[model samples]
Each structure stands twice: as C-alpha cells, then as structure tokens.
Target: MRDRIVRRVILPVAVAAALSAVAGCSLSGGTGSHKGPAAPSGSAAGRADPQAAAALRGVEQATVRAGSARIESATAMGGMLSLRTDGALGWSGDPVGTLRITYTGGQLAATMRALSSTSLEARLLPDAYYAKVGDTFARRLQGRHWIRYGYGDLAALPGGSGAYLTDQLRDTAPLQPVRLLRACGDVRRVGEETVRGRRTTHYAGTITPAALGGADAAGLRERLEQAGVTRESVDIWVDDRGLLVKKVERGELISGRMSATAYYRDYGVKVSAGRPPAADTADFRELLSTRGS
Candidate 1:
C-alpha cells in the first residue's frame, strides 16, 4: 500500500498539470486588454512624456520603499483556468510570502474537487515554491505534504513555460509592473480615477521588452521571450501618496489570452514564511529523478 502511494506521488501528475495551466501564461481577452492603446513600434518605442516618465520613477521608488504589503490577485488564461491568491508579501529584499492559492474555475478545478480540494497552501521563498498537499493525499504522501519546486530546477525544464515560471517566481512582485512601466518608457497618464474608494492617478503603457534599451533591457527581453510573450499591455493606479494601489497586466500567449489583476494594501506589513520540515517535504526534482529511474 505504501509503495503504491509513493509511486502515485513520485510523478505527481495532477500537480504538474495544474502548473502547466498557468505557467507564465495569463493568456486572456475580456479583462480590458483590447481597449487600451497598443504598443508603438520602430521609432516610437521609448519617447514617453516627461511628466509621465517622472511619475513612474516616483512610483517605482515609493513602492520599493514600502517594503511589504498584503496582496490579493486573480489571474486567468484563455477563459479556461482562473485562480486567486491572497497573502502578504515582503519584497524589501528577496521576495517571500505565504499564500492560500485557490484554483477557482477550470477543468483543473474540477479535478481538484475530485481529489477533494481546490486550494493549496503555498510558501513562496526566494528560491522555491513549497506547496502543501491537502488532507486527502497527505496520508498517501506518507505524512509528507509539501512539494518543493526549486526555481533553478524549473528553469532547467525543457519548455519555455518552465523558464517563464522561473522568471515569474524569481523576479515577480508588486514592484514588477512599475519597473516594467519605467522600462517600456512610453507611458501615458490617463488622468485620475477612484480605486477601492481611494483617488488614484491612472497610467497605462504597452511593453515590448526587445524595444527597450538599458541595464534592465536584456534581462527583461530574454526572460519574456523565453516565456513566449511577444508583448503586453499594463496599467496601474497610484494613490496621492505614490503607492501602487492596483495593477492590471494582460498579454497574449500561444495557448490563449492572459490577464492578471492585483491589489495592494497594508504596506509595511511584517511578513514571514518559514520553510517546511524536510522530513515532511519532497523535492519535485528528486521525485522526477526517482520516477525516471
């Protein structure tokens, strides 16, 4: 009985399939991607308005100074899979957080329900994502409920999705959109708007990583290209205090349309995510190796 259970988890097909569903692809349409101005090409790339450039620079600074915050985010792809995450994340240094990630609607959600769960407790450390299995499979996992996917191992995976996932896990944070805005440099200030009852200045831009040039240009282009993202539309809301209150980034992928919306609050919050016990955890790479053998 133990051997059978071990075999089932060695490959962890269900978990791997769920990863593929979102793996760097928010690829979606309805969430306002088409409504915005498309990215300019050729000579029009980085000529952002002076005021807009300055504002984004301030935004980048403000958000980075805030250090950490509570985040609620939802992402969907091609109308097929949607998921949400709620947690506090610390980005003062290496990103870290503990999030309850729920697969809300999708064929994958159905499979999770069949397994008696649609949510997973994920600990996001600087180097890896540790997903805690549900009770239904904990016994079968032999009291080992955690599965570790190291970012380096993920980057080594053959597909572009893995590299994309690596980029997302490693470089992603509330500060990402702001950085992208500064990098894209063709930002437009869309005046003021109310967000979650707070007044905010709306800003929008299109990002084509390859068109950008600077210290950040090469890394952005390489990471994005490896993820199969040709271009993206991003928008952000910054409050009077210059903190990012919300952001929307949408783009297309070979599989479908992708969209993600995130809200930030409770800035300066103290965040902690201690590692799982090694005895109660399994490294996904090790599991793959064992299965292959």
Candidate 2:
C-alpha cells in the first residue's frame, strides 16, 4: 500500500517538476515593465525605436560572441514548483551544461520529501536532459541513478507547447532572451542600475510570441497561446562590457503566474557535460508507459 501511494504521489511530482523545468529553461521571458508599445497580435513590424533596437542588437551580438557563462537562476511556476539552478552554459552550438537544481518551495518540494530528496542534478545536452537521482531512490530504481528525457519524445506530450519546448531546448542559448526582446521591436533602455554590485544598463519590454519572427513563428505563437502565455514583460541588465549580467522574466502561464530571475557572469567560462552511463539510465517516457518501469 505504501508503495502504491509512493508511486502515485512521486510520479506526478516528477512530471510537474519536469514540465516546470521545461518552461523555465525554455527561451524567452522577462520581468519588470517599460513604456513600450502594446504587444502586437501577429506582427513584429510594429513601429520600433531604432536606437533602442540597435543597442539591444549590440548586446545580443556581444553575448553571442562570448559563447558561455556561469548562470544562477531562480524560477517559480505558480504554486507548483520553485527551484534554483546553478551552473555554466555554453552556447556556441547547442547548449550543454550541468546544473544543480534545488527545490526551494511549492508542491513538488513538499512531495520530494517522500524520496528524501529536494534536489537533483540536471545535465542538459543538445537532444535531451538527464536527471541524476540521489541514493534515496537509487535502490528502488535498480541502482539507476539517471533518468533521461529526450526533447523529441517530449514533443509528443499532450499540449502542443511541448513541441515548442522541444525546439527551445535544442536551440536556445543564454543570449536567447536578448534576441526575443529585439524581436519585440519596441525595447527601450530603462536607465542605469546596479546588479550584484556591478553597474548595468537596464532594458525592458513586453512581447508576444506571435509578434516574433523566424521559422515557426506562427506555430510558436499558437503553442505559447495554448500555454496561456499572451504577454511577457522582460528585463535585462547589461554590464559595461555589453554582456547580459542579469535578466528577469514575468508572465502568466496556464497554471498561473510564472517568473524567473537569472544572473550570469564569467563570460567565456568553460562549460562541460557528459552523458550518464547508458546502462544506469532510465528513459522517463518508457517508465511512464511501463508503470514507472
């Protein structure tokens, strides 16, 4: 009976945590406000402040040039999940890194106590994300300490947004927020501010997926709409070196309010990740189908 209860509570929590992580790492969100134009429905052709646009473009190019950075981030998804992730991310090609994710609060945190775990290590690769389980659940998992979630398989998830998440996971870099804000076409320099003791120029704007360009623009819009992401306010802090030092994204998700704050530093930092041993890893999709494998 206890095993049954454990299975029921733990699986859902895992799913919730995974999905929230998807949204959190997914490209493009920001916080704070500005006097930008109202978010457009389906066009990035809205009147744009050319000067601000150029400035952000410079930031985007600078960030892209740096290639990698150490990131510390906190994310909240309604009342379902709250986590802090610390790691380094490299984005020259596909993003790859390892992060220690600690459950800070919310439902998932409470349920994680069932396994005596409130934290996990996530390794992000080009095609999948791997979760490392601690010893508490390793015994039950047949000494399997890793669970693999393929981005391709996640696309098959119920909501269409899962596909969007898949795409973002494969292609997004830390500089993605800058590109998204540039797509907003009305981004503005919000003045100067100090972030973590470093002087930075603040920039903020509001955007909708439909108002964005690039491949799959329409599909991205539709998926985000399904997720209840209509408009997101984005704030980025750039240091004198023209790199993103801090960013905050705030918006409403289907579940409720969703927000994230991330700080970046040590640009050009070497980032590394390696796949967990195949023999000791479980595919989460397979586990879901085979009654937790």
lDDT of candidate 1 over 136-252, digit per residue (tens): 656655678888888888778675656666666654346666766767767778788899999999887778766665567777677556645567777888999898888887775
lDDT of each: 0.66, 0.67
Top-scoring candidate (lDDT):
2
Weakest 10 consecutive residues of candidate 1 by summed lDDT: 22-31
lDDT of 2 by residue, 181-213 (tens): 777655777778898999998877776776776
Check candidate 2 and list the clashing pairs: 30-233, 30-234, 30-248, 30-249, 30-250, 31-248, 31-249
User: Which 10-residue window of candidate 2 scores lowest in summed lDDT?
Assistant: 26-35
User: For all the candidates, what are their Cα RMSDs to the real structure?
Assistant: 5.5, 5.6
- The TM-scores, one per candidate, come to 0.79, 0.79
